[model samples]
Target chain A: MPQRQGSLDQAPTGVPLTIVRLDESDLSLKLMEMGCLPGEKLEILHRASGGDPLAIKVMEYVLGLRAREAAAVWVSWGDTPLRNLWNSQEP
Target chain B: MSLQRIFLAGNPNSGKSTLFNALTGLHHKTANFPGVTVESLQTEIELRSTGKVVLVDLPGTYSLYPQSQDEWVACQALVQAASEGIPTVVVVVVDASNLNRSLLLIHQIQELGLSMQVVLNKCDRVANPGLKGVVQWFENEMKIKALVCDARKGQGLNEVSKAFGQRLAEARSGAVSTVPGPWAASWNEVFGQGLETQNLGNEVIRAQHSAETVERYRRINQSLKTCPLHETKAKAALPNGPDRLLLHPVGGILVFVAVMALMFQALFAWASYPMDFIENMMLWAGENLRQFLEPRYPAMSHLVTKGLMPGIGGVLVFVPQIFLLFLFLVLLEESGYMARVSYLMDRNLKRIGLNGKSIVPMLGGFACAVPAIAATRNIVSWKERLSTIMILPLMSCSARLPVYALLIQFAVPEGYILGIFSLQGLTMMGLYLMGVVAAVLSALVMKFWIREKGPSYFMLEIPAYQWPVSRNLWQVPLRYCLSFVQGAGKVIVVVSLLLWFLASFGPDHKMSETLTGQATPPVLEKSYAGVLGKALEPVIMPLGFDWKIGIALVTSFAAREVFVGTMATIYGLEGDPNQDGTQLRLKERMQKDTVGGSKEPLFNRATVWSLLVFYAFALQCMSTVAATKQETRSWKWPLIQLLYLSALAYLASLAVYQWSL
Candidate 1:
C-alpha cells in the first residue's frame, strides 16, 4: 500500500488518507459499521452520484459510505501512516 | 458465582446514550429498569475465560436523590439493583467540557454513599494544551481512577470498561469499600419513613449500594480537572452587561420573531415536497386497492374504498411532516444551536419567574410532553421540575400538528390577512407563542403560589462550536421513523378497521336500502347511528358542527390524529341520510344541517374557528394521558391536567362560538 491521491475514477481504487468526517452523531455508535475512524487507514474505490457516497473498503467490506461521515475521518498519506497515530493518548 | 450490575448514570446530555449504544452494540437487553417506567436498558457481557460478567448502560441523572421525574426513575433503578443482592456498580458520566460544574453533581452523588466509577466523557475535545496537565493534576489530587473516553467514538472503551469492571468486582468482593448505609435512605426519610432495608425492593436496592458506589463517584469527582483544550477552549471576554444587546427587552422580542419566522419558513419549505409525495402515495395505494378488489367479494365493496384506504391514508399524511420536524430538530440540536436558543430564552423566561433550568424542559416540550416531562430532571429543584412538568403539555406536540393543520386549512382563510401577513403562518406562530407565554405565565403564577427561591448560577461551558457529530445527527431521523412506523401505524390501523365496522352496517338498515347495497343507494334515514347524529345535531348547532363532525369527535377520543381518519371513513360512504348515514354519503349528508335557519355551509367560519380553538386547548389523546400518568407516577396530576385542559377547551370554544354568533 504505497501513497496515492485517492482518485475517484476507478473501482477498488486507492487513497492515501483516512476518514475526514462522519455525519454528526450518526457514526458514533456504529463505528465499524461506518468506516474510517480518526487516524485509521481507508480508501475510496469508486463513487456514485458525484461522490455523494463512495464505496470504500474497510475491515474487508467495500461499504457504501456517506461523504459527510468520510469527511470527519482524519487521515494521512501512506498505508502505514497510522504508526504515528497509535501512540496512546498521553494520560 | 455472583453477577454484578453496573449502573451508568449522569446528567442528561453527558454522552449517556452514546455510552449505552457503545457497550450494548445492539447486543444489549432492555426491560423497564426496576422501579421506574423509564427503561432500565442494560447489556451483560462476560469477560471470556474469567467467568465474570457485568452490566452496563443505565439512565442519566444529576443527583441520586431524585429531584426530577427522570432522576426519581434512575434512583429507583439503583434501589432495585441494590435490593437484588447483585453488586451494583455506578459510573458517573462527567462532561469533560464542563468539569467543575458537573463535579458539583459528582460530589452530591458521591456524598450519597454509593459505589461509582467516573467517565471523563467527550475527551476527544481535549486539546493537548495545559489542559492535559490540569487533568493529570486533578487525577493525582483526587485519589480516584479517571479514564478519559470519547464515548461517541469507542475510544478508551476496552480499557475503561475493564478497569472500572475490575474496580467494581474488587469493591463487591469486599476488597475495596467506602462508607454507606445505602444512599437512597435519605429519599425514604424525605418521604416520611426510615429505610426498611428488608423490603424486597429496598433490600435489593440497598444490597447493591454496598459502600463502593460512594467511593467510586467521590474518587472521580475530585480527580478530573476539566480545562478546555487550547483550540477547543479559546474565548474572548464577552461584552460587559446584564444582558447582551440582542436580548434587550424590545430588541429581544424582535429576535424571537425572526427565529420563529425562520422556523415557519422551514416548516413549509423543508416539509412541503415530502408531504406531497406521501399524499400521492396514499392516493395511489387507495386507487390500487380499489381496482384490485372485485365488486362481488364479501366485505370487499366497502373494504377497499372505505374501510382500509382512508384509515392508512390518514396516518401516512403525518409521516413526512414528522420526519421533517425531527430532521430540523436534529440539525439544530447537533449544531449546538439548540443550546444557544435555550440560552437566549433564559432572561425573558426568568422575568416571568421560571427557573432558568426550566428552559431545557420547555424547549423539549415542543417535541413530546412525555419526554419533555422526563427532561425536567435536570432542574435541580423539585418545585421547578414539578411546575415545569405541570405546564409542559401546553406546548403543542407533533401529535397536535394534524389537528392544527386541518383546522388551519378549513378555518383560516388562505388569503392574506392584515394586508401583508400570511395568515396561516402568523396563526401557527401565534398559536405556538401562546403555549410559550402560557407556560411562562403559569410558572410565574406558581412562583407566587409556591413562594420558593431558586438557586441562580451562571456557570456554563460554551463548548467550542464544532461541526456537530454526524452519528448523533443522522441517528435521529432513522430512530424517529422506525418508532413512528411501529407505534403510530398499529394504532391507526386498528382504529380504522373499528370505525369501518361501526359505520358500515347499522342495527336496522336493510341491505338494498343502504348506499353501498343499493344501486341507486336508498335511505340512511333510519339507521341507528344516523338517528343519533340527527338527534345530537341540535347540541352541536351553535358550534357549527353536524352529525358527521360529531361522529369524528367521538371517534377521535382514542387519540387526536384519529379525528382525520374518522372523518375520512364516515364521509367516504355514499349511504343514506338517516339509517346508513355513516357511509360515503356523509360528506353530502353533512352539507345541509341548516343551523339557525341559514343556507350556509354547516361547518362555517365561526364553527371551524371554535373547533380550532378547542383542539388547541383540549387534552384529547389517551396515550398522552397514559404517558403523563406513567411519567409523573400519580393519577392526581394527569387528572388535574385533563380537567383543566377540557375545561379550557370547552370555555374557549364556547367563547369563540358565542362571540361569532
Candidate 2:
C-alpha cells in the first residue's frame, strides 16, 4: 500500500507519524536540532484550545509547536509500525 | 592565584541552572552582560583539586547560532571568551534520558574547538544500565569526560566538580581544545575551516544552520547506533496525568483563572495586615518625633516629620504587597506550571503581537510594573516584549488600589447593588476592569505600528511538573524585593522629598508669611506647589479639576497613592482639622469645599469620576518610568509612554466629566 502523507498539523492525534521533510529551512533547522529528524517517529499529543499550538511528543520529549510551524513539517504513516528510533533499538 | 573560568551551557529545560546553583550554592552574583538585560550568574567554586574556579551559568540556548536575546547573549559570551583567549572550560549540561538529541549541542560546542565536558543532569529519571552506556560513549567516541548527576536531588555533584577540576587543570597546563572528532572535520569541510566571524545574511546563516543541524543529527544517530544503549528501558518521565487537566482546552483556562483568583485573594487578604501595621508604625514614629522636635527646631521638625517620614513610609508600605505578589510569581515560575500557562495563552496573545511568555509579566504588572517590565526579558520577539512593557503600566497596579479606594469612597454612596454587592465596591471593580479593557485595546492598537524585530516563533518546552525546590521558593522573591527596594525605592524617596519641598515653600517670602499667619501647615495659595497648580488649572479645567486637585495631581507624579495624602494636606491647611488624621474629617472638608468663585460643591459626581478616571490611566509612578528606561536601555520608550498615557488620561477624563455633566 502507498503510505499516507500530510503536514504534521493535519496528522491525527495519538497516531505515530514519521517525519518526511520540513518545508522551511529556518524551521527545519530548529526542528532538526531539537531532534525532530526525518524518519523520527512522533505523535501529536494535544491541540491547544484555540487549535493553533499543538503539543507533539518526539525524542522522548514533548514540544509545543504552533500550527504554522507544524505545517512546515511533512510527516507520513508507513505500512509497517515504525518503532520510535530514540526509544527502541536501532535497525 | 588567577581564577579559572568554567562556562555552563545547555538547551532550555536541561536543568543546567539547577546544577549551577547546586554546585555554587547561594554565593553566586547575577550580573547583566555589559549592555544587555540578559543576566549572567557566576560564582567561585572551590574544586577539590583546582582550589578556586569561577563557574559561570550561560543563558540556555538550543544552538550556538542564536535566535533570541538570551540565546545571542549566550552565544556571544562563549565566542567572545574564546576569542579573548580566556582559559575557559565549557561544561555542557545534557538531559541524560534524551541523550541522542543532547549530543547535537555537544557536537556544536566541540566543533567550536572549545575544551568541553558533559554533565548528564536528570539522570535519576534514566535507567542505570543505559545511562552507563551513554557515559562510556561520551568518554570514548566524543573523547570528553562525562559525569552522571541528578542535579535536582544534589546527587553525584562531586563527580561533576572533579571532572571540571581536571578539565580546567588541563587547560591551565596549555593543553587546550576538545578532542577533534570526525564530525568536526566534516563540519569544517562544510562551513569553512576555522570558527572565524562571518558576516552573512540571516537567510543564508539560517540555511547553513539548517544544513549543519541535519548533518549533526545524522552523526549523532550514527554514534548512538555504535553505543550500547537501551533508551526505551528509561521510565517515562512525562507528567501526563497532571498535564491532561492542566492543558485541557477548557479546563486549563479555568484552572488558570482559579489560580489567579487565589493569588489575588492571598495578595489582598493576607498582605493587608502587614500593610496596616507598617502604616500605623510610621504614623506613631512620626507623631513621637514631631513632639520631640516641634519645640526646639520647628523647621527641622516640619522637614523630618512631614517630608522624610511620609516619603519613606510611602515606599516601605507597599513592600508587603510586592513581596506577596513575587512569592506567588516565583512559585508559579519555579514550578513547571508557568510554561503550560504560556502554551495556553499563546494563540490569544499572538493576535495582539505578544508571545505566550508575555502573560507572566502582564500578570506581574498587577502587583508592580517595575518587576513586571524586568520580567519581559524572557519574551523572544522584540516587538512583543516592547509592547508588553508599554502596556504594563496600564494594568491597575497595587499603588492605584488606594487611589481608587479613596476616590470611590468619596464619590459613590454606600448602597447595595441588586441587594447584594456594595455600590462602592462595584465602582472599584469597574475601575479595575476599565484598566484591563484599556490595556487590551491599547495592545490591539499597538500591533499595527510596532514593527517586528524578527520572525516570531512560539516553540516552547513544557517541562515535567515537579515540587518547587524549597530554597528557590523564598530566595527568588527575596532577590526581586531587594532589587525593587534598592532601585525603585530610591526614586520614590527622592520624588516624595521633592514634592514636599514644592508643597511647603514658595518662590519667595510667601512660605514664612503664610506659616506664621496660619497653623504649622502652610496656606495652599502661597506655596510653590499651589502656584504650579494654578498654572495647571486651565489645562485640567475641561476635566472638572480645580487648583487644589491640580496640586494633588502634581504631587501624585511621585505615586498615584500620594494623591489622597496631598488632598488631606490641602484640605487640612484650608479647612478645619480639629480631629487630626481622621479620614472622616478630610472627607467632610472635601464635601463642604466650594468652587473658587461659586457656591457649587468642589467634588460633585462629575469631578470625582473625572479624577478617578484620570488617576486610572495616568503614568503616575516614576519607578515605572525608570524601570521602562532600564529594561528598554533607552529613554525614548519611557518618554513616549509618558506622553502617550498622559494624553490618554487627559482625554478620557475630559470625556467622563463632560458626559457625567
Q: Provide chain B TM-scores across all predictions.
A: 0.75, 0.80
- Give the C-alpha lDDT of model 2: 0.73
**Candidate 2 lDDT tens digits, B1-661:** 4567999998877888777767765564652211112456777878888787888888787876665656766777776665556678999998776777778778778766667889888776555633777778877888888888887778888888888888887777767655554444433332342322222125655666677778778877887787765454432223357777888878888999778766655655567689779778876887788789978878777767666776666666667876777677667866778888998889988998788878777877776777678767656667888899999998888777657655676688878757855676567657766887898888988899776555567887766666666665565556555665665557656665676677777675456654454445445677787888999989999999999899888777877767756665555446354457432334567788788868988888899999999988999988799889987778999999999899999999999999999
Model-by-model DockQ, in order: 0.01, 0.56
Q: What is the interface RMSD of each candidate, in Å?
A: 21.0, 3.2
Number of the top candidate by lDDT? 2
Question: Which residue runs of candidate 1 sit more than 4 Å off their true CA positions?
Answer: A1-91, B1-6, B11-13, B21-69, B87-89, B97-118, B129-147, B152-253, B331-353, B380-383, B412-423, B435-466, B510-532, B575-599, B631-633
TM-score, chain B, model 1, is 0.75
Candidate 1 chain B lDDT trough over 10 residues, lowest sum: B234-243
Give the lDDT of residue B295 in candidate 1: 58
Instruction: Please give the lDDT score at residue B25 for candidate 1.
Output: 47
